[model samples]
Target chain A: MAGKRGGNLNWFYLLLTVVVLTGVGLMVYGQVGRGKTRAGKASMAPVNLAAMAEPDLIKAARGVNRGAESARVEVMVFSDYQCPACAYFATNIEPQIVKEFVETGKIRLIAQDFPLGGSHIYGFLAARAARCAEDQGKFWEYHHQLLALQNAWAYSRVPPVETFQSYAVDLGLDAAKFNGCLNSDAHADLVTANYQLGQQAGVTGTPTVFIDGRQSLGPNDWDVLKAEIERALGL
Target chain B: MTAAPADHAPGPPANRMGIALLALIGLMIAGYMAAYMLGLLGAIICGTGGCETVQQSPWAVFLGIPVPFLGVVGYGVMLGTALLGLQPRFLADRRIAAVLLAGAVAGFGFSAYLTWLEAAVIHAWCRWCLASAGIATLLLGCAIPEVKKLRRS
Candidate 1:
């Protein structure tokens, strides 16, 4: 009688074990499927128009503006407009930094191109567009447009050159000249040079802001940036 | 007669070890779940949404439900099973106790896989997740000796 009872208990335990394992396997399947769905959704989203409109003034072999630069301290911003973190900083942090410091002439902000080629294909082109806009004296206007429209081109499998051209036209730029500049490899060297300069300056990631040539490695809110600017300015 | 008596006498020790290990696993699970809940709440309150981003990521959901919620349920089940083993009638069944420990072992293995995913693929660490993994591992380790003894008996 005892032997029969033991056998019954064994069978019951085995059944429970199988049920638990099956539950775990089902969970793994669900997780993988969800990840694929998310990836597909991300791929279908529309390109960001605001990002293309933003000006990227920093180019290779470009000399620093020594005279019109009114700030006491020089703040170099090495950024890729396509970078999400850069967009976050632009939207959440840059405005306060500009208002409290840059506009007040306490810090002169210098923009540089550090396009991450593999992930953000249009990053360099976007940088070039901003530089071309700078030639037309509308750098900051274009800068705002690019960061604002960052997600516009995010999902595009192909680079959106025509979209950028439209932005140049809307900005009252000479379309013929701008289109030629966009297609020509003329500014490619400049973009490469700026990337190299950023790398040499110990910039490991996007939106790396250098205050008086000191690298700020991580995210810096208004107060932290202001304090660094003050220290750099000897104030 | 002497040999048969020795084999039967082995039942109490196996039962005691299984219960002790299950209780320890229960405590660990409770501690981790509390931490995760607190962290999730803190993230929501801060308005940064970094916590939400981490939570919403593919890693957050295992199967269909949130991983934290699963942890909560798994830990509760473990505690319940351990309490069941404490009853006089349940303690007499050595085979049943061993099977319960085996299920706990399986839980430990799954938790290990999740921990690997978090550290390597997700490239993020959640302290509560780590604690749960650690607790599950300890429970499995404790159950091993008891399981071996049961097999011998």
Candidate 2:
């Protein structure tokens, strides 16, 4: 009788293993593939990033202007350094945009801080750090370093302050000035000001791009963005 | 219910070593969970730097609370059952061993799911997370034979 019961139990164990393995395998595969796409695809409604009634050059703050201030077409970017989608845009697409229109002096790019406080761990600190770097005349270089190495330090439970310092050192900024600025929260107000500006503009997520004060489509795909920029430039 | 089968007399008792292992695993999970909630993980576990990534990801939470809190509860249940199995009164109940086996198997399945999540979705490896999975698997293995040795009463 014991032998008979043992035989039955073996079949049950075998069946359970097969079922569990099959269910888990499919779920993991599906979720992993989906995680790569950005949240930008879900919404196409162009955003103003501030609550102004009209697109005005006076009201829209172009804080970190990357191109000549006199450039005809101005592109404003509301972004969080710690955001995966924003990192994707900065690392892959922004370089090409810089090369084509920005470098040619046909366009001006404004980078505004819009750190999403809820999902990101180091978003606010990274924003302040970048602003500190900006004070020393190396904002874009520091921004590039942070976005390029998003995987390296974003996961830290504590703010990766030392990593930011290392970046400042690498960029050849005056360590005393940079460290003093970073430690004292010198750019905290600037970061907050940008975030408040974003809130007033009713911005929902990062990488919200505006062309000539008008919200454009998205930064996910290059061709759509290029056409939008071309239209703004009357090219 | 039928009487105890002539072929088996409840064997001896559930292996005590397995019970102790369950308790140790429970404590380990609790320790890791405390560090996670208190934001002290980096000072301790920084082997591959993957633990930080895995712990801070948005998926680390379930309904706004860290998922490791759930692991703590599961481990507590495991510890309770294992400790209970030490007494004659607890083992006297025919269903007690069965319950222990069921609990361990359920814990094993859950741990396996999380392992897959770390590997595929998170794209990071946490040594402590892997240790919990290994412990759960061992507990399940220990429970199976102990359940088999029970009489068909």
Q: Considering every candidate listed, which one attains the maximal DockQ? A: 2
Q: Write down the RMSD of all candidates, one decimal each.
A: 14.4, 12.1
Docking class of 1: incorrect
What candidate 1 gets wrong by more than 4 Å, as runs, is A1-60, A63-68, B1-153
* Interface RMSD values for all candidates: 12.4, 13.1
- Mark the regions of model 2 whose C-alpha exceeds 4 Å error after superposition: A1-62, B1-153
Candidate 2 lDDT by residue in tens digits, A1-235: 1133222224433543564466456546644553443333333455444445434532543479888878999888888887766776787779989999999999999899987764465788999889888988999999989988886787665678999999999999988888888888676766777777766665666677778766655554678788989998999
TM-score of chain B of each: 0.66, 0.76
* Candidate with maximal TM-score: 2
- Can you write out model 1's per-residue Cα lDDT over A167-222, one digit (the tens) per residue? 88888889998888888885788777787776555555677777766655234355
TM-score of each: 0.50, 0.53
Residue A95 lDDT in model 2?
94
True contacts kept of each: 0.00, 0.00
